[model samples]
Target chain A: MIRALFPVLAILAVWVLLADGALACAVCSGGDDDVKVKDSYVAATIFMSLLPLCVVGGGFLFLRHRYRATPDE
Target chain B: MTSRTTSLRVVTNPRPPVVPSAVLGMLLFLFTELMLFAGLISAHSIARAGALLGWPPPGQPRLPLEETALNTAALLLSGALLIVAQRVFARDKRRTKPWLTASIALGAFFVIFQGVEWVGLIREGLTLTSSTHGGFFYLIIGIHALHAVAALIVLGMNWLRLHRGILAQSTFAAGQVFWYFVVGVWPILYWRVYG
Candidate 1:
């Protein structure tokens, strides 16, 4: 129980630390400190990062399942 | 010593893999490419959101939204045509030729249109070093265009093989996988960059 909890706690701490950086952009012209902009930026970044993974990963998993199901037929 | 006679028989029953190794390899390659695009997109999102004067910035020429929407439709049509070609190829190779040709034509048109659009943008003062907006626009779209060009070459080769009556399913499928990747990635880029 304790060993599993350690990883979860570690992940949570990292997430907290990285939260601020998530709202930052390399090419931004600056001066945008609005709460809405910051929140939307974080959300969009996360969505962009995850969307591709979900698509490609889900496709791979489906293919794997199908491959396993139809063997030597 | 007595002479021994050996008989050889052809084996016709062989087990085939469920998914071709070539297609699987392409999928893995596309996954990595997808990650690269994701990183660029994430940066674009951040830049757009955090900008002081909103996205596209002040004094920059507006992105051609309507023109690109039509281009997007053409690309999607090309994807559909390619699917038809793949399906028909299995049933009749000769019949598949026209579909493949049409698909290639549409895809080439998309690339050509993009080139024209880029020329216009450059003429209008949008370039790599002009601004961050210009930089991201060129970098992201240029990378995608590079992949599209390479995929077109692959598809062209596959078409040549089809003409020679030697287009193997694995080779054709590999070309299709790359084409699909090129097609699949565009809409996201369109929404983010153009829309």
Candidate 2:
């Protein structure tokens, strides 16, 4: 297990080094803009991510409720 | 009184049909696909937020927002026509064919228009590798186009099967479910990508 972890750790180290460039946002980097671009991005990201779950999960729950409400025939 | 005798009987009531399993299965599949698109949209949101320049990234061709709205209307109308087709299928099976044809035509029109728009954008030097905006544009819309094409093919197949009197209700419903996902998902995409 220790030997197996070595390669994983090496890959993680590489990713850690490269991750900074990948994560940096343009708005946060430089800009005198009206709306805080970083905040907008964060808001948009959260909304987009949650939307699918809400839609899909809500549909499933609704269906289940309906199923239970239905009387045995 | 001598001996008493008893009789046992089992009674069963027939249940009405609920949503067909095929349609439900398709719905589940679409749910997953919705998440897939969500991931793409999230990426776009992050990219657009970070974009230092006005989005479309300095000199990238502006997306034809107004023109695409017309196309979006066409797709929505197609969905409406599909509902009509389903209704007509129940009342007058023969009449449903024309409505189905119309729906398919509208869908194809949307796809073709998108292709035209893509050509225009490419001519304007907005290729996939051009910029983050260009790359995401293609990735998101390209995935949608792929789903639309597949859904169209399924709709076409369903149309053929209907004419032959071999189309099962479950299959027909499944096709409708897929089309609904394609149609329903576009407005969100339009707002995100275009707006």
Candidate 3:
């Protein structure tokens, strides 16, 4: 099994090395060095990333509470 | 002589769902919609920040902040009315009709007010192709308006069913989930695009 995973690990290492080249697009790079733009990009990224987690997590917690409140039949 | 026939019976006890399936489905749909709005708002923010001449582009007509605030208040009150309707529905279904009617009326008022606001903005030269500000404003707010209209339609249908006394608890819950999403997401859009 170890020998079988060696090629996959090697390919992953190569992909990681070239990840920066993959993000050279204008959208990914913000296409400008303006301070406000950069800040907006950062803030937006955080907002977008955390929003789904919060929503899904909250929903899950709600369901768990409901389940706990429900009596066993 | 000892041939005996036996009948088999399977006893089943089904437990109620933690969340009704319809409400859960609505919640799932709203989750995706929330992400869509998040993307749109994020794009708008990035674009606004990149603008060199500052936001609203210099020549664009300013958004009607105070007027829209009044409209926002109406939408919020409509949402509050819906909550009251739902509570009344739990206790006495007969009395929920008035509260539900009031909520729908306010929602309609909000949509009509927004339409007037759009007409005024367009006359002031805020067309979609006029400026980046115009483009983002219409794109984001227009999507929101579409959602509001669709939610209104759903609520209208719910009202009809209630009038007929055929609305199921799950169905009403589903409609509430959708309308609440429309109500809840508005303030954020207003802040981001208008403010």
What is every candidate's C-alpha DockQ against the true complex, given to 2 decimals? Answer: 0.40, 0.24, 0.58
Rank order (by DockQ, best first): 3, 1, 2
Total clashes for model 1: 0
Report the C-alpha lDDT of model 3 over A1-73, residue by residue, as the tens digit.
9999999999999999877622122753355767777788889889999999999899989999999998766
Q: Give per-residue lDDT, candidate 2, residue B29.
A: 91
lDDT string for model 2 (B1-195, tens) is: 799889976657755446678887898899889889987887787678767687988889999999999999999999999999988887877778999999999999999999999999999999999999999999999999999999999999999999998888789889999999999999999999999
TM-score of chain B of each: 0.93, 0.91, 0.94
Candidate 1 or 3, higher TM-score?
3
- Please tell me which model should have the higher lDDT, number 1 or number 3: 3
- Name the regions of candidate 2 deviating beyond 4 angstroms: A1-37, A65-71, B1-17
| Residue B173, candidate 3: C-alpha displacement in angstroms | 0.6
- DockQ metric, candidate 2: 0.24
In order, the first chain's TM-score in every candidate is 0.56, 0.60, 0.60
Candidate 1 lDDT, tens digit per residue, A1-73? 9997999999999999887644234445343667656776768667876777798789879888877887572
The residue-by-residue lDDT of candidate 3 on B1-195, one tens digit each, is 698899986647667788899999999999999999999998889888888887788989999999999999999999999999999999999899999999999999999999999999999999999998998898988888898899999999999999999998999999999989989999999998989
lDDT of 1 by residue, B57-130 (tens): 88788889999999999999999999999999999999999999999999999999999999999999999998
* TM-score-best of 1 and 2: 1
